[model samples]
Target chain A: MMSKIVRTMASFLILFVLIYGLYIIMHGHSTPGGGFQGGAVVASGVALLIVAFGSHSIHRSLLERRLSILISIGLLIFIGLAFGGMAKTFFYNFLVGSPIFGHIPPSGPNPGEMSSGGVIPIMDIGVGLNVAGGLSAILLVMALATTVMEVEE
Target chain B: MRKIAIAVSLSIFIGFLIATAFLIHPFGYPPSEMDDYIIENTQSETGANNAVTAVIFDYRGFDTLGEATILFTAVTGVVMLFRAKKKREK
Candidate 1:
């Protein structure tokens, strides 16, 4: 466990970290960051919590099984979206002209739109989920392993 | 003789690196024929303002899929390695 000050600070800071990460993920199609980067950001927050509270306490709520399931769900969403465009060709932007997320920006420089980018935004969310879950699970397991070693010692 | 050979090889490798660095394209001006096409058509075709995202998720999605798979495999390996010991102890 960390000092009380660190724990308190981490708890307070995780909310902003989560929101910023989600913003990056959601605006991936218009911004600089995307799924992997945003997901890494979210995982860093989890790392902060792990460092503050120790793995055992975090593990009680965020189990490896749950994380694994989250990873699976993300993979499924991503692959399903990919397959959805298979009729045209794999990874086709099938939603380009559709009513959903189908607004095309001007040819030149302009401000971006949220409901644009067809399947890109959805794929961003999926990859973000997968990356967040996978990274957090790895960190938690490693922390738990180290704790076990310390106990043994 | 061995020391001379190692020095010669190291210098040769360093020289090759320098030569390649000088010969490489100037920054931000890659010699890709597809760049113009992607830039011109990305907004209309993919409906995305960010060309990079359109390329990754739409044009070259297989790479992302493979990357996700690699991450999944890594997590599985890590969990399996540690979970077995924990189960045995309990």
Candidate 2:
């Protein structure tokens, strides 16, 4: 376990990092950042948490098995969205003028509506989830393996 | 002899890096017709305010697919490698 100061700082900052990361992912259709960058940011927060709380406790508390499931679900969401536009063509932006994420964006530079961007936002979400799960899983696995090696030694 | 060869290779590597840096296009002045076309048509074509997102999830979706595939493959490989092994009674 980390010191109280470290833990407190981590607990305080983790939420902000997570919220900022989600903001980046959700606003990806209008902002500079997108899914992968946001995901990495969130994963960095997770790494911070791991460092603060130690991996074993986190592993026990947070079901490590569910991470793989999350990864699968993310991939499914992405591929499913891709197939959702199959009526016209593969990855066709068919929802570009419909009710579901189909609000027409204003031409030229302007503050964009969240409801706009067709399937881009959804795809961003999918990629964000996939990256967050994959990166965190990799980090958790490495930490756990190192602990096990230490026990063996 | 070995010291001279190491110095020669290090200088060559630095020279290559310097040449590439000088040869690169000026900052913020990339000359590409494709970029202009994408920027002009992103909103109308894909209904996305962010051209980068439209490019990733619409214009170049196949590239995103490949990226997703690579991530999935990596996760699967890591899980398989570090999974717990059961012990057999002797």
RMSD of each: 2.1, 2.9
Model 2 regions more than 4 Å off = A112-115, B1-28, B84-90
Best by lDDT: 1
DockQ of each: 0.79, 0.67
The 10-residue segment with the lowest total lDDT in model 1 chain A:
A106-115
Q: lDDT of model 1 at residue B51?
A: 90
DockQ of 1: 0.79
Error of 1 at B36 (Å): 2.4
- Evaluated on chain A only, model 1 obtains a TM-score of 0.96
Residue-wise lDDT of candidate 2 within B1-90, one digit each (tens)? 999999999999999999998899988888989999999999888887778889999999999999999998998887677774312211
Report the Cα lDDT for residue B17, model 2: 99
